[model samples]
Target: MILILFFCFSFTVDQYIENGRPSADPVVVNPVMEEFDPTKKPEFIIKPRKQFADEGKVAKFKTSFEGVAQVNWERHGQLLQQNDKYKMYPALDFHYLEISSVTAEDAGSYTCIVSNDVGSDTASAVLEVFETFKPSPTPAPKKLELDVKLLDRDVLEGTQQVEFKCKFSNATTVYWLKDGRKLTENERRKMTFDGVFAMLIIKDISCLDIACYECVATSKRGEEVRTSCALTVKRDKQDCNDETGERSKAPEIVSVTPSDLSVKSGEAAMFTVNHTGDTEVKWYRGRREVEPDDRLIIDNKSGVGHFTIQNALPTDQGVYNVIVTNKWGNDSMLVRLHVEDTSIFDGRDVKISTENFEDFYILQDKVGKGRFGTVHKCIEKSSNRLWAAKIIKCKEKQKPDVRNEINIMNGLTHSKVLRLWDAYESPTGFIIVTEFVCGGELFERIVDDDFVLTESDCAHFMHQICEGVCYLHAKNIIHLDLKPENILCIAKSNNLIKIIDFGLARCLQPGDSIKVLFGTPDFIAPEVVNYDEISYATDLWSLGVICYVLLSGWAPFTGETDSETLVNVTQAKYDFDEDIFEDISELAKDFIQKLLVKNKDHRMTIQDCLKHEWLALDTVDGQIMKRLSTDKLKTFIARRKWQVPTPASSLKQSNGGGPSGKAFLNGGADHWHHSHHHRKGHMQTPRSSSYSNGQVPWKKNGNAIQAVNRMIGKFSSLSSNSSISSSSSSSPTSSSSLYSKSKQSS
Candidate 1:
């Protein structure tokens, strides 16, 4: 058996080439051998070389052999024949196979066989197909619609400005040209492209701007569409009468836009004028012609003129004019349009006619005071309207932050968020005017003697809070301090809540973060305590604390002191404690738990909280909500408030550089929670008695408010206690008077 196996191995070894290279075995004849016979055996003189081909290109493999009469070719062991795709060339010295339009599938080993009557010889070469990168025409929309509209005013001399707008549909790569020269964006020449539209605003127009301006929109396919406008810069020496088509007579205006117009921000505003005769009319913003398109529009025909502004913004406020010209003469009307901000505050249209702070009738005594200044209940003498004004001293250092807050408020608008009526600079300080919330703090309402906040009340209030907060988040405003004190009721009769006190608030850009450790200790997120990046999640954590306190009247993480509470927050050490959460629904606890997660990314978002089962009022019955136990919550709140002494420092004004805003007390420790069962009239007792009734053992200036405009690098967030005052005038001084007035108005 061993001898037979050895013989078989020797036979197999003789049939294969050693190392897969050319073999010179005695049985294989050599091409140089003079005794070689064409029918005896085949020998290779040239072996096939590896070939490479690009996709769609032709590829060829060839080899030469001696003593062979027949040549055959195969690919990957498959027999090949001459065809349209494959060509075979056989000669006495060479044999070859050709593949036309080579593809990826054509890539493989090609074997050439040279044979005689006696034996055969084989040589193989690899065919590799590669992809070629060729220049391709850019793909773009061919049928583009292009329109050019005047943006600002007509081009005048160097004094005025001009703007032209170009709009395109289904195109790309937009650029502008002036007098055939491509114009690049610069300080004076501005261009902006918003996918579908392109605008070119030119300031300081002169004779150089008199040439034609062209807007060209090009696609990657090298296709382009263009629109052009000729700007005729009229000098002061030019005859206005000639342009009007008359020598002496000029246009006479029968009517024009009002001297002043006002519109709320984010809304639309229109201006129209009634005039006589066919007069040439043009619109101008300051020295520049107001472009008739973009955000502004103008129509002058049939002796009437109309100017409309869509989505009026505060930046749109400017002095505008309409110049009417005719053969006889010309007349122009200057109109000033003011776009008021209605976001952070309300009643922006109510003009504060009085410039002096003292001009307002001090409607009541000071209701609340903080680091900013005293909260006042004042009435405008002319309108007798009520308002709440929080005055902050405008020292140079604080001016920028104060102005920033004003600017932020000016841009915000949400039902659940407070609105800024107006911000005025006074000799004493800056008066931030906001609508008076007569219902006072929701915390006060929850603990009121006769008012027990059923789960329904909590849900309603929480929904409103979510709605407002969602809007704020949409606008990129993060209310770093969200608590019961910051949440105010529209009025006693109206349970709607409005978020206030943006002192710690910040407007975030994408991927922004805060890390100054600035929130109430008990409600502060673990990330904040660890000095991690603060984000919108910080507000969510605070909201969780508010929900917990509102439902259970107990803090989830508050310790005896601020430091201890901060440690607990850092460790996320808190629990339902069974006893406190026994009456709270599982859904409510779930919502709070999700928000209170130590990991910010794991925390529930405002959108998620809004959809939580506890807040999903649409799916739940009103009866179920109303049936949720509030008696236990009420008892816990009252007992806790009376039990914990109002820290003198909590009521005392702190000059320290921390968040001196109102602290988020576990149970609204700043104010007393009156018994709901107390026998009283239709009017609820005011908070003024807390100071007089001895519930507050401290005065207003004893560091009572802890979070005061915390330092953030060079910037400071101006956090001051928001005073509950009247909405019509400025901040009223006393809450009792406002309550009385609110009851009468109701």
Candidate 2:
């Protein structure tokens, strides 16, 4: 048995050696089995760690695994793909995920999944996104102050040269004027400025050069400081005697053109005097001599004297006098200059009266109150006609806005638009006179229990509104704030309506697009909420909301909160409730539908609205006329009154909140209601007992006033940073997308 076992072991050993021996011809083996291991799995060699990134910055995650594996990326269990926003790279042992233009929504836990047939492993890291820093509000510029005044100078008639000097502070440029005409550098005249000092030198001075000399300094902010001095030229006795015993006689006036001149603002006005004189003439406005600036010119020739005003302003309206002297008797003639009010298209300056408002009209009881001013009913002293006067405090910061409104109102001539009679600027404030609207707001009329409103009536009102809007659109003007509160009737019994309040209106030029952060919450367009380019369709959207409210007593986009309402507007998430819209005709629904489209290009134009079949429909389905119930409208108005938040609440909400929260806190529901009731040209309701007795009640709620003031302040602050005009094409963005972008850039 031992011999047999030894022989078997020796054979086995010889067989093993034969099988394991190296040879020039290599023995083949199973390559997969040689490298494979049953217990092997993916193990992280370098795991991603927690990272922090600023919004709008790039974020990257990297990992390396020891075993062969396929790599994938996920955020909160949702698989991520390589697209414009995301990118992924995989190698044999390394993987990478990169996100571009990171936003607040990208902040979360990111996972890198590695898997193979054997097993799988995941490495997660938290990504913290932070907002970029925002710039602080710019402070108001300092007012330019004048420090010195020009002094009078005397020179001989044949003096070789004369110089006038003046000093000023905060002046960016200085201009020299003679008899109200701007001076230019020539052979005989020279002007020089050395920092704070301005000088004017005239060579070969003659009698004609003897007139009022003015030094006008202007700052970069357009603030002007003016000073004047008279230049008296002493004549030689021999020239006056003229080699005779009798002295030279003064010129005699023959004729004067335009003895009393009347011209519109921004128009050119000229007064020519035909006289027999050998000397020069000087012009004067009141006691002060008229200075020839860029817009005023004075000329004296062989036999005539002319005074011309170019682009006349309201302040230029006055009595002008011209005097001619030839060393003998002097002749003088006076002419009155009147400048009529012009539109913004004609001139930026509005004709404002320095006279007291009470001088022209008898101030009566207070009729209304607003965020910036108070309204009063007045009677024209000359015509005994009734009018409404809006009095606003003349704060330096608000003057431009008030003047802009006046200019816009002056430009409008349509009967359906509010008419501006006059405007007065006083020491303390401004008083604007407009047509008296006693019929109250459209909502007030709708709420009246005895008032009957039919679908046809709604159409008639809409027709008038469309006509007004069409006229405005033709002029490139868009009334951004169009609502029931802005529509006023001529009389309680008539259907005639007038649109008011141009504070939010804009005149868009070709290829102009503006983005502003202001509007009534219930009527704001989706573009407004998304901070996209605003166009004429913005007004059409408001019209659609107005029509919707008229037909159904509820707001289409109203929600429990302002932010929610904004979200609804951006998504166009409103439906026609059966209870409120069942009685409405299909054509009417179509009209509103066309106007309320989210894409501005798809919205109906003003001309289309005017020509729509619904406005021309006399009867619906050839049936009896249907009257809408006022109960819902009354409820809506009541709800609006209570929706205004107190100032304290707005302040609390604005503090320590996110971007959306702060925006809503500043210009959301509270601002909408406040602006609705307190806008310029708002009419008081006649339902109040005080109004019935010819004494309109001045309602003053402490909380309401405080809230309105706060709203106005908020508007001023935001307006400084809002309304950006861009040349880039506009693309529609959802509310959530805008929110994320705002967070990333705030």
Tens-digit lDDT track for model 2 on 584-676?
888999999999999999999999999999999899875317878878888887676445553322321111211122123122234321111
On TM-score, the candidate that comes out on top is 2
- Model 2's TM-score against the true structure: 0.43
lDDT of 2: 0.65
- Return the clash pairs for model 2, or none: 179-292, 180-291, 180-292, 180-293, 181-292, 181-293, 182-292, 250-329
Per-residue lDDT tens digits for candidate 1, residues 137-247, read: 776446766765533244446754566877777777788876557899887889989978888888887644555567888875677887766565544433445565644
What C-alpha lDDT values do all the predictions have?
A: 0.60, 0.65
Please, what's the RMSD in Å of model 1? 18.6
For every candidate in turn, the CA RMSD to the true structure comes to 18.6, 28.7
